[model samples]
Target: IDAMLEGFEVSKENFSTNFNGELLIITITLLSFLGLYYSAEKLTSRTSLTVSSKPLAIGLMIAIGIGLHNLGEGLAIGAAIGLGQVALSTFLIVGFALHNTTEGIAIASPLAKTKSPISKIIILGLIAGSPAIFGTWIGGFFYSPYTAIVFLSIGAGAIFQVALIILKWLYQSEQKLVQASIVSGVGVGMLIMYLTSILV
Candidate 1:
């Protein structure tokens, strides 16, 4: 959600001169996200794995979503550095590092009951974290606001899809629409994020 908002804000600031181009970019991004989600769903259904497929798929998707978000973060870091804002870059690096720690829990939660291997977990971590390197390089060298908008939009869409999946899973598991634990957990999570955002 934040990523999407940021993307739009950037577009408004940088791409206002090219409204048609901006609209096209947003349309393509949204369609791509829908395609990706459906493709993932199909792949998970067809693939055979030693562990349960759904949980592993959820974890993988979450990793991918977080990776996309982190990519944007990396872009910001590299952009700050590229522009010679050393202090801002350093602060972003530290803040993003701290912020990303919680993402590990998001990736791990679904797989908690599975007998997934450590090697697989490591791969997922790499999937989630490696994009930041590429993002940094791109931001440092190219540093296009247009590119940032696309990446942020895709990240936001991926996260939104993951949230839907998790909610569906929860509903199916409990056979109910809402639960007290879910509400409390969501509230606490939001509160924690808000506090962390202040620090960031």
Candidate 2:
């Protein structure tokens, strides 16, 4: 099959199904997000002399990461619905809904440590939730493996940055018990996701 995209031929042989292209995109996207996060952290530290701004920025950054992650989940749910897999779509919607609730807490946990206002928490919740709905709408009409890969890559980049920032917070707290619990939580979360994948 002939596939023309942006004046370039995108064939099965030439597209990112190959290892090198996939690696390049993954590396570039991850590094770019890391760079962005690093720069933002530095710039915010320099400019934000006020106390409130920093927390708001941190909350917003976390919300963005979780939002992108949820959007990827929405894409999966939307694609399933698009493909007429009603049962699979339903299962995914329910599962993602439950998963995102935990994700919200993950987003909130750092801020919860601080004295965040109720209004800010509500805003972050909307930021994290709106993307899923938007992504589902987008996914219903468009179906492309390449597009999905891009979405997933961006989401992974953002989510990884959030994890790194949280790790730094954990280090600062100097609470061994909290760190151990985090490690245990990671193990349990991975196990659950692995088991759930088997169902699909």
Candidate 3:
């Protein structure tokens, strides 16, 4: 969602600039993110060789991924408010507040399954969720297209890495439903994001 929507704005603005090479910049930014996601996934997957603190590491990885993704969401809100799109921003806030309930499930479920301590889970929850508020503060005051582009790309990358890891985990479980679940999950997530988009 971050990459597609924000990248659209960036590409359009760049086009309006008569191809001032912002398109190139956007392309490079996206490719960089894709590369980063690939590298991170490769590195993290190698952790199967290590046993100690595996659960803690996995929990932290999920938290970091969630934080990165929400940072982009915050950027959208902050950017909209910065542009004086009050109605859009308000709708976004309302939509996001509702959407975040599901996000809370995503953040907590893996940690709970790992039997992480309650205190640690609480702390991880904070780590996973604070970025939207913080990003809003930054975006509202310091909003820049390039900045948003960079952060959004990074966030998208982090989110992809987490998804890849989760899918890999599910694959190792030898479940016949892996492909269907992945497809269904993607469809549902896209649908939700699309529904939220109507608020704008």
Candidate 4:
């Protein structure tokens, strides 16, 4: 949501000329990601496996989404540093680190019941994190608002897809779709995120 809003804010600055084109770009990028994700999911499902693949698949999807989002974050960090906003860069780094701590849980929760190896877990962690390095490099060296908008939009799309997948999974797993525990869990998570943002 935040990433999408940021992209929207960026679009507003160029509303006279680029806004429509940016929207098209965002829509296309978002749909492309969704298509790719579903294709990959279908391909993986056809393969035979020793363990249940659904959880692993979900974890991987979550990792991918989080990775995209973190890449945008990395861009912000790199842009800050590139522009010599040292204090802002440091603040972003700290805030991102604190916020990302919870991403570990998000990535791990689905795999908790599975016997996925340490190596697999490490790979997933990398998938969710290593993009920040690339993003930082790009933002530092070739920072462009247009480029940022695309990446941020991509991140927003991926995260939205992940959220939908989770909700579908939750609906399938639970007897009641809107259980109190689920609601409270979401509320608590939001509260925590809000508090962390305050710190940032």
* Top candidate, metric lDDT: 4
Tens-digit lDDT track of model 2 for 113-149: 6787889899999998899888788779885666665
**Candidates' TM-scores?**
0.84, 0.77, 0.75, 0.85
Summarize candidate 1's per-residue lDDT along 84-128 as a digit string, tens digits: 989888777777777767677778877888888989889999988
Q: Give a tens-digit lDDT track for model 4, residues 1-200.
A: 78777777777776556357466657955784786579547844764263577777877878888898889889988988999999988888888887778777778877788888989889999999999889999999999988888888788877777677667656755546577966786787788778767655
Lowest summed lDDT window (length 10), candidate 3? 20-29
Candidate 4 — which residues are off by over 4 angstroms? 18-22, 47-51, 174-181
Q: What are the root-mean-square deviations of the candidates from the true structure over C-alphas?
A: 2.6, 6.0, 3.5, 2.5
Q: Candidate 3, residues 110-197: lDDT per residue as tens digits?
A: 4444656788878877888898888898899998876776677667766766666566555654555437865786678778767876
What local lDDT does model 3 show for residue 165?
55
C-alpha lDDT score of every prediction, in listed order: 0.74, 0.67, 0.69, 0.78
Task: Report the number of the highest-TM-score candidate.
Answer: 4
Arranged by lDDT, best first: 4, 1, 3, 2
Please identify model 3 stretches exceeding 4 Å from their true place.
14-52, 173-191
Clashes of each: 0, 0, 0, 0
